[model samples]
Target: MINTSTMVAPWWQQAQLGIFVHWTPASVPGWAPPYDPAGRAHLGWTSYGEWYENSLRFPGSPVSAHHRETYGSRPYTEFGGDFADALSGWDPAEWARRFRAAGARYAVLVTKHHDGYCLWPSEVRNPHRPGWHTPRDVVGEFAEAVRAEGLRFGVYYSGGLDWTFQPRPIATAADTVAAVPRGAYPAYADAQLRELIRRYHPDILWNDIAWPAGRAAIRNLVEYYRFTVPHGVVNDRLYPYTPLWRALRLPGLRAAYNSWERRTVVSDEGFVPKKPPYYDFRTPEYSHYTGPDPFEITRGVDHSFGYNRNSGDDSFIGRDALAALLGTVRSDGGNLLLNVGPRGEDATIPPEQQRRLDWLGEAAGVGSAP
Candidate 1:
């Protein structure tokens, strides 16, 4: 919905490499499977981390049953408010330094996850008031740090998928819908988002878990380009307005987002089903725990990039693997986005991960180390 006239940089020339950081208050305890009474693993908890609320639509699933039992059938706010101060030792500068050293052209940090906890102060709803409210403006500091290192800054917002804010789905017609109209919330969400834009001036808006009823919210966000960032790029996954506008036609649509990037995983079903044309860019994000050969981004290294607390082994892509992967993508004139899930509150990248990523940068002949 952003005005087409505001674009400054040609979409075809967007950065070829991006680093996605997925940190949530839930990540404080690290990645763990949700428990169930019958001892069967829950489907919702298994796929994604921290975004459990978005997947709780199934009626009799473990997440639903477990949530109802623990929180007395209330909304997700109850559990969201239960976050602890696990990251008293967070240092944003260290993280920025490492990311820059890793040759990341841009970085996406989690501003507000599905749990409804805002890393920076939010005026809209004190969703995580007593638990993790901070006056420090964490996201602002991240933007400053990232920009200082000369990398593009971005924020990953989950406003559309806040279980604490919109506990039940739009299909659930209840009094809650009247109290919180999805239509009006776009302005509130925009207000909160504007605070970040005012501070960070991010180049990209990475949104997650887009819903049907929340279309206006993102459209309003695009409209913001008229006043604020005229050249800002928004991911279609944010609110499903359209696939990222791109140039080179992959299997998907080649219209709006002229530079497209697909975040997929190695699966038994062959990298999961997607629309045709496959498109301009596709970055397969292998999780912490996956197979050896299939998980490898290239033919060389065997590793996983997504966060894994227990993964002490260098299961992620190594320098050789990274170089080869980037080389392959570059040969085709596409981009690569490596993801790292930082510890909650502890904003710095883990020391071990940093060392390996540094090695990758060195091996790939990218990024100057600070």
Candidate 2:
């Protein structure tokens, strides 16, 4: 097990505030049902717009019904073209300015979400979905822009559950474990992550879901990352699907695991893996950690992290609520990684989301946008 305690506290711990940007092809059809933040609903009813493709696969799910009514049999993959076209008008510098004005010390962009779409034109081709990534170097431009504003840059990659590889609707905890792509995915993810480290030298390696590789492989990758980007920090979600998790696929075990997952989701303690090989900090999504360990609270300004066309002012976190949340996190000596989901059609941050950020800036004594 790699010991993060020996390493000095990195810049992230002191940064306090970071902005997480989720801009994906899913934003083209951005819509998700109202989220029950209490974690009462199943994955099929997920409120995350970024999970648009997966939710659409569930029969009779709201996303599927919405897709049929809205797009009229258009495939989800077609959104890639629309997303590419929309990128023509995106201004990375403008986004960077907004983040800086919002009092963000760092900005983490979703280079690749679970939908298997890469924001950057990666050299490591996706065998299952060729030409699926954007032609423009979205990651590079965003990184440059953020750094130019004196803010650290980071990247978020879905190391597990690439929909193109598995194509299964994850409806349960066991399914979520089983959805980790096997065979080529482990190697492909490794290569792509290494490429990102080499090309972008991101200050943070924020992976989602779980890593497909085992402990040894993950350790090697972490070592390489530390050597390449000495100041880089890794999140806790890289926990691999080990034998214990694999056993969850068993009928009886699956039921028990799902029950536990449901309980954990709503627990006041928040969700943290039993024992991971390594992680610089814990990430509690839409939840919080009660332990003294270093943690970062990550959640969108609205219920969904990706732009949701259905979300209104009621779905957003108001200024007072935002202030309270920040105060609580700060009191616990943790950082807050607030998220922004720009529209896929024009890559513009929605006015509702911008309003919250502007409020945050004013509260931080940073002048709000005029």
Candidate 3:
């Protein structure tokens, strides 16, 4: 029998602030550098990065127009080479230093987004698109840097979607769910995740869109707990649909934390009812919320999570707004997860985002060792 009394809460709970990096091949041109609006009527303008390649799939979409005008019928895979060249100069240590200065207690990096480009070279080949991965071990280097700074390290895996496995681009809301790989993808993801565990031993496992609804997922998660990290932290996003997966897994295996990311309702919702659906912590992105329970608010320094050259000074979450947000989230008993979307060509945080970090760092006792 496991003794529940002696284990202390993982460091992530105490480490209030974090940095969520959203960088991928989309950052290369950096589709308008992921997801350009199609035609005048095709959603006008949007910045959801996972929809980058999808936008390119639309012949009349702005993404395709821009690509045709610029790259001229070049396949999306072509950008991988550009991204690789850019990543060659990436400085993981510099990023860690910046995070420490920005007052981040932990850092979550996107090892793989929906586009299916693995930041780390994976032995698990994508049957649909092999050799799409970079030679760099981005996850490993970043993990080392963050841990060296005494900050918790976590990885974000898109267990639910990998566009390489699906040829059709996601256009409508229905396409989002439909694009989920149903064949050998679960097992393929399983192999990659196992490799992640074996190679990185991440302190936090942040799976997006939830895991595949199958025994493979269950098995991977079980082994994750059993071997990789017995007392490690995990977020509530383990299941794509909460209502269904909530009852599917072992009750004891529930994630250590509950996260509500990418949702915009930021005002305080009185007291959070810590009942059946217990949430260790709540995440409020780009807004502030009121509650006694722990809440982590996320702020994307720029308009887009992935690199977007089009984002001007007006679109950025500059020093003033960031300062205000930091104060607000702090006062509300929450953490602020400031996001930085690095450029694909250089894997460097844009100058605008870095300026914001410098502002935060200039303040006294901010993002300091606690």
Candidate 4:
């Protein structure tokens, strides 16, 4: 087993609040169907604006219709250029200040999302899309700013799904599993992650979905990470796929697994993976887990983790609700990693999101570092 015992209780455990930043090319369009709490969990109709490119692949989906009407014949790749242009106005220091003022003890930025756009000018270039990464050193600037403000910094990378490698539209849980690209992807992800660790030395390594490589590779990476950053923590989503998981992709099994996954979400159980070789804490998205293990409850202030144009005041977590959530999570010995999805065009945190952060700052006393 991976020797997590060597490290003391991680800093994240005591950090009751962290800010999650999700800025991407998808933020340029920045639209998603209005989230319906009572509706079924359909991938195509997902409320996450960050999934715009994937959602566009589904014919007749709202995003597809929106894209066609808004930016006819313009490929999703073009958004990368638009996003780069928008960076001219982005101020990472201001972002760090906002996060610090919100009483965040730590801040985790999505360095790479599913769409395969790198926020920093990464040395590991995308093979399919040349120079797909941002010209701005977003990751470096943000990391520096956050640390300067005395808050721990972390990076979020989508290790399992890089649409540039597979470009598959995932509608089902099985489809998600199958979409984990094989071939050069495993090494590519590994190198990028190592680079993040080498450059940032982040306090938390927050990975999403699953690692495309199997258990051994993930274990090795975790070992290397702990060795490099002794106090750093890794979340549970790095669990690797097994032969049994691969079997879920079979047509007959795919439908069954998909049905079960949807049911789990509807029932509010969410999809927590079986324990991997090792993890410092569990991460549950838009779900709650009150078991014995340490976990972080991550969700957008609104229903979507990315800025959704459809999200209004009604869609946001109210001040009272947010306070209750914080109380409950703290009582259960968990942390809350609340997300902020800034408007891509101007890098402005929406007033709705800013108001909630302001409330939190006032309630918790701003500028108090954990």
Best by lDDT: 2
Which of the two candidates, 3 or 4, achieves a greater TM-score against the reference? Answer: 4
Best by TM-score: 2
Candidate 2 structure quality by residue, lDDT tens digits, 1-370: 4444446256777889999999999999999988765543468878889989988888788899999989988999999999999999999999998999989999999999998999999999899999999999999999999999999999999997799888877888678887888879899999999999999999999988889989888899999999999988888888766767667668999898888877665444235554467788878877878865678899899878999989867888888999999989988888999999999999899989898889889999997644
- In candidate 4, clashing pairs total 0
Task: Give the candidates in order of lDDT, highest first.
Answer: 2, 4, 3, 1
- lDDT tens digits, residues 8-125, model 1? 3444244666667766655543433332224322334342445445435665654466556655666544433333344456666777777777776777877886556777866666
Q: Estimate each model's TM-score.
A: 0.65, 0.95, 0.80, 0.94
Give lDDT tens digits, candidate 3, residues 59-79. Answer: 877667777888887888888
How high is the CA lDDT of each candidate model? Answer: 0.51, 0.87, 0.67, 0.86
| Residue 261 shift from truth in candidate 3, angstroms | 15
Instruction: For candidate 3, list the clashing residue pairs, or say none.
Output: 26-30, 27-30, 30-33, 31-34, 35-52, 38-61, 86-345, 103-367, 266-288, 268-290
- Candidate 2 to truth, TM: 0.95
C-alpha lDDT (0 to 100) for residue 99 of candidate 3? 87
Clashing pairs in 4: none
TM-score of 4: 0.94
Output the better candidate (1/4) by TM-score: 4
Sort by TM-score, best first: what order? 2, 4, 3, 1
